[model samples]
Target: MAALDEIQTIVILMQENRSFDHMLGHLSLEGLLPDVDGLRQEDMELTTYANEYRNRFYWPFLIQDEASVIRDPPHSRHLVQVQMARSSSGKKFRMSGFVDSYIQYTQHQTEHPPPMGYFDSRGAWMTSFLARQYCVCDRWFTPLPSDTQPNRCMAFTGTTLIDDTDSRLIPHREHVFDWLNARGVRWRVYHDGPPFFLLFGRFHELVGMKYRPFSELAHDIQHEDPGQAPQVIFLEPRYFDFFWSDEPANCNHPLALVCHGERLLHRVYTALTCNPEKWARTLFIHTYDEHGGFFDHVPPLPIENPPPPGADFTEGFKTTGPRVPGLLVSPWVQPGKAFHGNLDHTSMLQLLAEKFGSGPEDYSASVNHRRAQRIRSLSEALADAPALRPIPTRAPEPCPPMPSMKRQPRAPNERAFQKAALELLQHEGPIATAAKYPDLVGAPLTP
Candidate 1:
């Protein structure tokens, strides 16, 4: 049998707005996984020089938990350029200026900006536990430096013709769901609420059949026939964008507590691992969509061949963004192993293409060019370890109780992608859009 045949299920859970250094950098401090590429003694602290009005230096301190962050830092394309501080020659990325950029866009001034902070394993227990028990990709970067939607577009369609995360509906492109459907691969998207796939109008049809509520995941795992179960699954945590109402917003966006997301992870992991037969053949992956303007020590790798331009984006795409947390949980991966190969959101597409073959050759030109980049495949991590490791018996740490909702004014730097998405819904008619996104019912479009 082919190597791909050995795996019967692939589950991907993509979270939001965290950098590798911000989330898992301190993993090494625990000393459980010594070989992992995590924070060292010298890396515990980082300093950024700023001269907004006078010469000043800012040093990053370790944040105790995620809830302490009051404001969502600006992560627009222009602001990210300031954060990276690429050299004039365009050959070197300095990875400085975070404090300066945060201060420049923030409406409220504070003595300490949240952008200049990192979290240790204590606060990110689920992420740390998953990384320690399976594989962590230290070199995995987001395909773009912008905000949520663009990098998410890269993950779903293997290209982000548009650069920002405005509220506009994505242009018609070959989505991963379409690819899986074409190849006769069974797939499903289990989301806590309104599915992100709804953002793309083209995927509306599949939403009814393949999309499901989060509750159904556990039931399906326990009762669905193993042969008929979805071969590919995309799990979505409760997105923080819908937090205006009383709901568990567990996607781990800056405004929400990380503990909520950790609880979701624990539930997902328990559901998948409960059955040994299914667990042995399943490849579970957890990753972040983008760095969300957090501090990452490693600079993005340059992309030689940018994706073909779209109507919205004439400049084309170039350069991967900062490293984000990537964990591959599988029995096939040896415990404590770290994969350092360069990877990004498109790497998921590359792996799918390798396993199921690329969909219709003419489906998408931009996707074809991205494939030509020869990105590393997720399957590569399993090549060295042919035998399965023992299933984990320990339970994840208990998550703290959800805190009270403290409504705050929306950030002034809301990205264009979010605005565009909301506009698309409005165009469809506000009443109907309100039925789907209740938070935006009476909400003003103006920031």
Candidate 2:
């Protein structure tokens, strides 16, 4: 096997929610703006509702007693968005509200809201890791107007809500996996459950997929060969009751985002650094699918163009949510630097396609076509100096195990939340869902 420095594998870990500023603003270590300053005055007012409620109104709930009640009332969906937008009123764009707000807008009805705060905090763990260890894109944004499926598509396919609105629906165009397959690149998608979109339909023809359950992730990594290991890897967390697991000790507990951050750092550090042959050449990119209605000050860039081919959604789309957080960690990029360049999910696809020699057809031709001077590369995000050698030979401390969780039979209210979400998904279908949900905006599911 070649030395770790010689290999160029890219491992991308994309989580679900959180805007760039909400999570990173408090990162005092980066000096990225510890306390609000003249330039950082654009931060969202995290304390807007703090005085009204002592318990910290991190997630917006229409009724004061939201945590105990899972019942998503008919108006809850609409109100969720309104409340989220209000919560993030300090953020830059008026259109960028919380997820529930957008959900109400897209569904054209009020409905139940899911556990936003719990999921976001968990996802931030991955983002914080990238910030501490690698280069961060402070100005990075999402290209699509709304939520997970389309934004994820942008990461892999380099296009917006073009083919399927629902993430569950498969796309017609080939994805990054196709390019990797054609190049004979070894890659895998590691998830707590079943593989998501990147592994669907014809796309599967191009890449390998595996279901290791959270319990098996580390064990699987132990057996990997530097040369035989996947060239690219993706990690997705499972969400249930604002917690990935149902362990009482770990259930819906409040924690400093940094705590979660440390955990994620340990995982990536081990995955790459442990295998001496894979550390140097590996590029690990961490980002969120969309901002889940967190307050952020930056507004989405104006995209005045028709949706690209194979795209089947409305155009002139605007996410209207606060800025989602993004980070890039690689040997080629500088450390402790914040890139203020304007980027969205499409940029991730652009980066991967270029690095792996994929064609532009997989992405929006408009963005990819203007490669002359317009194309911005993440190579600048690489660390100025390569990671120091003598890859430490520490006894393999196991990847932090996820607390065993039991999906207890859904409670009455929990069932309501799921039903509302399913109905919302069914009504909106795939394409509409992709177009409507943006980071930092909340959407309520309707019955």
Q: Which candidate's TM-score is highest?
A: 1
Candidate 1 structure, TM-score to reference: 0.86
Model 1, total clashes:
12
Q: Write the per-residue lDDT of candidate 2 for residues 17-132, one digit (tens) a residue.
A: 55555566545424543432111323334543221222323333222322333222211223323533432444433433443443444453233233222222233444444565
> What lDDT is reached at residue 364 by model 2?
49
lDDT against the true structure, per candidate, is: 0.72, 0.46
For 18-109, candidate 1 gives per-residue lDDT tens digits of 88877888776557676766666664454422213236555555787556564577788788878888889988887776777788887555
Worst 10 residues of 2 by lDDT: 247-256
What shift in Å separates residue 390 of candidate 2 from its native position after superposition? 8.7
Give the poorly placed runs of model 2, Cα more than 4 Å off. Answer: 1-7, 28-129, 161-168, 202-223, 239-265, 318-322, 358-375, 387-447
TM-score of each: 0.86, 0.62
